[model samples]
Target: MTTVLPDLRPGGGRSQQAVGMPELLQVIWHETRTSRAAIHRARPDTRCDLRISASAPDRELIGTILLDGDCACRDLLVDMLVECDRHLSDRAGLLGNPLGAARVHVRKKAVHDWIRRRRTEVGAQARVDRIRTSALALGLPDEFHRALLEYLADEAGVMAPLDSEDALHRRLATRCAAEFGGAAEHYRARVAAGMTLVERHCRSGTRVNAGTAAEPDKVTWWERYIERPMGRRPRRTDKPLVTAAPECGDGTHQPPEPASADAADFDAQVVAVLVAALRRQPVTPDAALRAGLDDLVSQGLLPQRCAIELCSDCNRFALAAKELSALR
Candidate 1:
């Protein structure tokens, strides 16, 4: 006669010690034999088969029951198999995932809050300041509070004017922009760069050698000479390099000249390469610039300064280094 294992659900509720392989085996047997939902929910089709087994005994160790069964057991065994495979595959990171990382982050945050709350010696202002610092560290945008407040109000069923659909949407949009604008800009730059490259590569059709291009300095000089003329016609009345006296010049600072089509094309290519790199990962300004520089280097163009920093300086990107730096 097949002996039935005891239900074990309530008896196995809590444990001071960590779970081990033996406990896992008990849980699986209990779940399969007693829990109708566990088996019925995992209805395996004809194609799949379930199998389980304990690892082969090594010196001084005994082997536990290995689960082996038909399709139903195979489906259930998949979870265990994955864990085993992970150990064999990449033992160091076998079970790591983004969701697990996020859970750890949230737990840490809660622990920090609990510790702060328990410190009776700390003043309320100090507590508030600590929270603000933590928020800044987590890269919470300034606008996040407004959106959060609105959301909480709505969730609590508060009938406040600010909870109106229009107000809520506006609040959400503002927060999203503040939180994600930099990331969005980086993504946009990459897409634009890729499209430009595809167009150029397709249009050019023939491979061109970089050796044919003029030296970078020669090119710069030629551009300057072409754009403007050299003449010793008039020496501007002596102006000291550093002086308290206001430097005399035309009231208006000249805007940057429109780029030539070729220059624009080169820029588009650089943008494309950097954008592609950013899409793959969050790049440091140095890394993004390096990617752009690599493309320029390949094309025999002078490497310009870091692209993101230049964009920041020019007020092209919504968020600045100072803002993202706050997160770090």
Candidate 2:
């Protein structure tokens, strides 16, 4: 006979150590896979497969779950976030070749137009912020909170360049990652130190989430049916999310700008690349600007201001450096 695991949900106390990040992630994926419908609701929530949508309507899809206190589907928030990011990136030429990466470079104006066209895609941050609201209201384990924030910060870095309209905190966090070290360490530290891009939401809107359990416990049922590695499987979430057939690179992404298109649009792409560089991820500002100037400048950008600006001036760059010197 298959034996069910004991309830191991951590009590709201320090004595119980939170599960490690890798294991916590596994548990979350499993919850996403196995989510069930609540017994009662205005309409029987029919999204049983839990396949997440990659379009604007995903807000409604995720909202349906987070707001429905009866199902307590908030636990799947992390996985939902993961799926959204993957779908968006994949659709945006996530492949590293210049052509693919170029296709990934969707301009902000076009980003809106693209979304307007048919709700083709969604970015990760906004949706995760929704989860952030719930996570804050119904407390999460300390490590879990930090990890969630770190994940947000990391995703912010990944998505920052593609869209310039990103939050300043997130942009700066990625900039810090670029200036200091890289996303994994620098922003991870900031998030642990209580800095993150998560802005506060309206307090009154959170009331509907009250009845749901803070986070559902994970199951160890896999240990019964199979070995540790392959045994684990996630249940499908009850409320199904939209899914689509794959496209070559990004389905909605326009082809690379033609020679006739405004050259400035192509020049702006350097910003995305440099931002990535500063964050030290895939590598994007001065660097971006230099590239833009390299192509646009008839005489090319000046190498220096008489080669003495750094040595002679008390400019912001100089002042900034001196200020930084105070750190150590």
Candidate 3:
């Protein structure tokens, strides 16, 4: 006798009694013999030839049962299938259509969800692998590596407000240079290399480069003072030089410049003062002038009679040095 099997439902549910033989066979193949062992044991006897009529829904249900290892409803489906098959065989008049004419529809949501989940997992693993590889390649000490990672994360947080990725990268480089005591250009190069490796392997398309912000220039204390219009004056006061008695013939004492001296004489005296100031190797203009005057007096270059006149000339030279130093 040719027994027609019922069609299988989309989700492996029991077939309806009103449905034809095609649907019945679908249920038997998909819901009942879902496993290889079940299929082997449930084979029909040689005298009772059995034929299956499977639809698209039946194929999908069978595929899902085979693929999903943790399908909790399989036992329930198997029990339902056995009951249906027994009922169908008991009624000899019932008939099922051929498998070719059967049409079945399967819900695609589960399949789609499974694919999406797999992709997400793959992407997450790729990211993890990329990070681990990059970290190992860095070869920094464990403590330093941890600190560097923390610093980078903190920097990224600070840069979150930046609208442009390029700008953010550049700012990060600048900050890294300042905090880590490395050249910004070098830091940028390293960052770029790391990002490139990540993008290539992880398939993340994020791009970052160093920012254009310039570091502030350093100014020296001397430069700071000299840049000003009025330079700092010497703090030291002039002290009288102790000299040997003239009777010893160490040097002749020249007379001081008279108040009524000619303009030429006054100009000559001013020139002498500046020449003295330039001779000293002191750092500041004020110190230079003071040391110059002291050297001239101690070396007996200046006459004892011109002590007052030379002192007054030294003061003028001090002012002149201030202006010259400021320009420099």
Candidate 4:
């Protein structure tokens, strides 16, 4: 029987074979984002809430717009932002030269914090990535592939192999029967027969034991388990949307005040993005910040002047002040 590259993985358990690509994406997105949020919340605070005085300069209101998928929105946002930046530079030139630089520095720090947080979260997400890769390699969708690998990894040691023809025959029979009983019984019988045939003909490739005592029923088993039966690809599951929440250690009160929606939202979004970026090894804090800023700016959720700050230790965003309005 011919096996697709994807079907060759000898081991993911029944459950792993059920997870599809979309589901894997969702799991990765959720777990990475969640961990990032938690770590950010736990980070030590940075006093970034700048006091906006009565004489504060007017600037453009910027926000990030989030869209599903790895699409072309990023390029579009960059083009638009480049065009809009002339006004910002001009305004900065007017701010006595040094103030503009200072403001830029502050914003950079905030963005850096966002990147650091992502790296932190990414640290916890390696397993998801590996599982997804394994699934794709095996030609299984996120649902069955990932779930099966995870199940096997968790239940049986990840090192276990499922390559033996005998093992394949037995498991496939059991799976077919369990998942599709009525039609599968016929499949089970057919595979059993094939196993018997392969055992007779194939036997040991080196040892031509054509006349030996029943050759392990290899051909009949292979035919019944692999060649004859019909197999249905499992459906992929939809990933549930996740909400990024602040952790208790975030130094901010839970259920932020209704009036403080702006700050709270800003905090949540920046922290979430930051956390997501930090998952990379040999992490780049600046790149992570740029990622978060780009996400927010594209979404139109942040003003041009707002900034994000990272904690030195955990590399996630930190809210230094207890009061939202006190600094802003």
The C-alpha stretches of model 2 lying farther than 4 A from their native spots are 1-122, 129-328
C-alpha lDDT of all candidate models, in order: 0.34, 0.31, 0.39, 0.33
Reference-based TM-score of each model: 0.17, 0.17, 0.18, 0.15
Per-prediction count of colliding residue pairs?
A: 7, 17, 11, 67
Measured with C-alpha atoms, the lDDT of residue 219 in candidate 4 is 35
Best by lDDT: 3
- The TM-score, computed over Cα atoms with residue i paired to residue i, of candidate 1 is 0.17
Over the stretch 196-275, how does candidate 2's per-residue lDDT look in tens digits?
22222222223322122776433221111111111111112111222224446756532223333566754455444334
**Per-residue lDDT tens digits of candidate 4, residues 19-133?**
2222222232332344334433432232212121212122331222222222222222222223223323434324333323323533444234443433333221113335435
Model 1 per-residue lDDT tens digits across residues 170-243? 54445445655754334333334432333232233333221235632222211121111111111122121211
Q: Which regions of candidate 4 deviate over 4 angstroms? A: 1-266, 280-282, 305-328
Better of 2 and 3 by TM-score: 3
Off by over 4 Å in 1: 1-20, 24-53, 56-265, 271-328
Q: In candidate 2, residue 165 scores what lDDT?
A: 16
Candidate 3 or 1, higher TM-score: 3
